[model samples]
Target: MPDSLPPPTPGEELIKRIAVRVREARKSRGLPRRVLSELSGVSPRYLAQLEAGEGNISVILLQRVAGALDLKIDALLAENMPLDRDAERMAQVFSKASPDIQQQVRALLFAHSQTELRAGRICLIGLRGAGKSTLGKLAGEVLGLPFIELNKEIEAALDMPIAEVLALYGQEGYRELEAEALERVSATHDRMILAAAGGIVAEKTTYVRLLQRFHTIWLHTSPAEYMQRVRAQGDERPMEGNPAAMTQLKTLLDTRTPLYERADSQVNTSNRPVKASLKDLLRIIEKRRFLDVLDG
Candidate 1:
């Protein structure tokens, strides 16, 4: 509806425009097809067939279609003026099909489309408190698969808090633990939602390891929001005022954005509600048939 947009490509757009307009009007009227079918004494399946145009819909079908679509029979038959050639062709193809054939074609097309969009090697990476645990758990639940927090594996193996390990053994020690944990997970062939440390990608070996094994997604946010979300979760120590903290954060974000951009996908959580963000992430995963991608 915005004027700034370019005009849609001709033909296919026309079919979509008509189909979408009709669908929108039907939804706005809030008239369920079942009720319309009952009112017209037509079976639900017959009404669905007519609406979807998967059968030889006739003048008799028009009455039911009109009623279901909450339009006059005349309106149903009204000329879709200047029908786009492509839409017209598509309409003709659909109209010529038997109901069973239409269903088969629809199913095959749907399956093929799904195959193209499925996800590969999914791993969630972000700074501490960027919601790797929360979102990873949610993703796992929604995906009906195992959820793994890499830090948990590290801590379990080292018998210490992650910070303690970092402090006592230093960065190299932590990297070793991280590498080992990553190796264990990489060997397990399954649909797993991994919550990875933010800095892991800075380590060449670990970064390459993750990219090799999982489809990585960066869960990113504005520094201010990241601080707020993290503090709200009681990880307030990171926010201890240092005069250069903001500068450091800015540099980190600038540097990391490029690294994270290497991910299979990136999700910005700054403006979104957590629930909505989780749902969006899940939708992306599902759209890509992430599990199938992993297997491949």
Candidate 2:
């Protein structure tokens, strides 16, 4: 036998380092799993696995998680070495960037992400009360595909109610579980309709994955309608006595609108009956498939 064993692969080393750094940052920041999950759109279970050095995370996902923790991607990926002056400067630049500038920078990393889609999966993306849950299920039934709510998947993964998970592990933990749940569903099922969380667009990396792997549709409605719908559905959180709640929500919508608009298809379901909106969405899907066949 040789005097020394073979060295670890580059990929293996990277995974180990990422596992350590991600866990360290989470603990240092005093962020629980749910909080990180909400911010990064990565699942707590997956983050747990990553911290355990068992996660096979992609660079894109890692970058997203790192950005959420306010770290530079390069710094996060760096091996167990002290940060050089240049690296520190780069991190500072990234940390201080305007939101628009940061988005533009991140966009460069996904240049080749959307060349083709998995064809068998479809995702609904939009803000809360956009009717993703309702419209997504109808679309699934019409198309004979299984309808999956991503939040429900997160709960199942954690074996607890979402609120409990959030309360126990924090938002970071919840998002980590959520992202892993989405990944599991994507890997396990070939044909399904996913009703993603309204804030899915906030995490560009996860949203990019959704866009690349699934045909995405934006279920859109007006701000007033969105609030009314959520209230009507008995989700009292939106109506909590914050007098400026509507203003805050509208501001959030404004910021996310551009991201939502990037979907492959869009249905503005405002002021329309459910049947009418569903019919319009079905037509969109059918027409797209017909065109896809023509291309093929």
Candidate 3:
């Protein structure tokens, strides 16, 4: 097995960390889970599930977790604590993330530093026609990081077109190829622009592993705009004989939205000019100070 494979029960560890923080906050506030739920407008059962680490929470629920404890949301999700003298400063940084994410981040830093690097890697994801390649290249140039398209790499690794590879090898084979491509990318340069495959986020283990290696940005596009762009790019087959193309596109977008939102930052790419969109994305990255966050 590869060294990068995330160990079993990662979700459980995350849940445990969340539960621990929730428990601590509840006690500190002198409130029971029911009372916390009432104040936060979250259900007691959900809150209990959250406290028990059995829930996969949304950003909103995470905020509610903080609110219920009178703690800031950031504090609840931060990956590390500061030193004794910097304890107060660290506490002000954000909520504590699960130990696993913290460890993952540390492992990433350690692994990456062993390689010497540049401006940190940035990952772009979302549906096709979201301008991940275009904007990712531009953003990478601006930030002085190398640009890499994972799909292109995957194709190169398989020595064939993606469609041909998929058709010949099947979905399972393609996933293995994808994993190998990702592993090769991860082992290479530490700082780069990653224009990732759109559906990578759908695979939990793969997504978490990649997250350990790159700061992710979700570039969102509306289905209408995506369809138009794909058509304009000469891939009109989706629109040709398939009357259900539009419906399927809409459903796919809806399904991926929540998953995409889990990204470090989100930029809606529909309608905006590419240049304008890249600038907005750059500002978002700077605002988040991902470089500093990653360094920590």
Top candidate, metric lDDT: 2
Per-prediction TM-score to the true structure, in the order listed: 0.57, 0.59, 0.60
Candidate 2 C-alpha lDDT tens digits along 54-156: 9498878888888777776776686653234455566578778765455445445434443233566788889989888998899888888899999898877
Q: List residue ranges in candidate 3 displaced over 4 A.
A: 1-119, 293-296
lDDT of each residue in 212-257, candidate 1, tens digit only: 5577778888888877777788865765867676678778878887
Put down candidate 3 lDDT per residue, 140-223, tens digits, no spaces. 888887889988998887688999998999887777777777777776666678998888888787887677667788998878
Q: Tell me which of candidates 2 and 3 scores higher on lDDT.
A: 2
lDDT of each: 0.69, 0.79, 0.76
Segments of candidate 2 deviating more than 4 angstroms: 1-116, 290-296
Candidate order, TM-score descending: 3, 2, 1
Each candidate: RMSD to true structure? 17.7, 18.5, 20.7
Error (Å) of candidate 2 at residue 222 is 0.7
Number of colliding residue pairs in each model:
6, 20, 5
Q: Could you tell me the lDDT of residue 160 within candidate 3?
A: 88
lDDT of 2 at 24: 78
> Which stretches in model 1 have alpha-carbon errors above 4 Å?
1-121, 293-296
lDDT, ranked from best to worst: 2, 3, 1
